[model samples]
Target: EREWPLAYVPLLIDEKEWAEISAGLVQRADLFEAILADIYGPNRLIEKGILPAGLIAASPEYLRPIAGIRPASGHFLHMVAFELGRGPDGRWW
Candidate 1:
């Protein structure tokens, strides 16, 4: 097996940039939580045609057995991580 490569230099971010990134991450997490909840709960997105039923049905991540079951914590997602990279144009994408 090949060993994974590591970055020798640490990437640093300014406080202002970090603040913006953090805010965007939080917003995205909230949206993900809502989408998961909807998929496992009412599934109105499918009914309303906002999301295709076959898409969820075919998704490996979709657990049909757990549909409509509320978690004890009352939230579907507790934590999330995102991989962000800067494009050649110097914009984060």
Candidate 2:
């Protein structure tokens, strides 16, 4: 099933709706960048008591095996996924 895929009907949105969706996506990406930066950088949240140090260490997503190995490009948390949703008005945007 992974080798082949089915095509879906093309989605068409007005410029206004497209702009709203694009802005939301960009904002979310920026937020992810900030969170990742804090986690792998200075860790101000843990220092300032906003986030518990124990929680981060206990999380399964925290990769202890590769703790010391930094990416040459200095990038982490490279994947982000969002659910497609609609409001009560039934608009995807």
Candidate 3:
């Protein structure tokens, strides 16, 4: 059998801090969606030299076979998880 580790104590945050964090996360998600849409669709980032074609092509996560396929939900990413860590300065990175 496998067991999952759980935290007994919850980390608390003030409303203002939570709002800032939430906004940053939303912005990150939006950026990810835009990047994914571009790479799989028009690829304007690569075409405009904002991103190198070779770099994206070499990535393991880049799926060349499904480049032009559209998702039923009309979004490439339905959900995403981010691994966050606090820096030495006590700021979340």
lDDT of 3 by residue, 8-84 (tens): 68878789977888889989998999999999999999999999999999999899998988878889989988755
CA lDDT of each prediction against the hidden true structure? 0.88, 0.75, 0.86
Worst 10 contiguous positions by lDDT, candidate 1: 1-10
Give the runs in model 1 whose Cα sits over 4 Å from its true position. Answer: 1-6
Best by lDDT: 1
Worst 10 residues of 3 by lDDT: 1-10
Off by over 4 Å in 2: 1-10, 65-70, 90-93
- What TM-score fits each model? 0.84, 0.69, 0.78
lDDT of 2 by residue, 33-75 (tens): 7766677677887899988999989998887666545677776
lDDT by residue (tens digit), candidate 1, 1-93: 335454668779889987988899999999999999999999889889999999999999899999989999999998898976676897666
Worst 10 residues of 2 by lDDT: 2-11
- Per-residue error for 12 in candidate 1, Å, reads 0.8
Model 2: how large is the Cα RMSD against the reference?
A: 5.1
**For model 1, which pairs clash?**
none
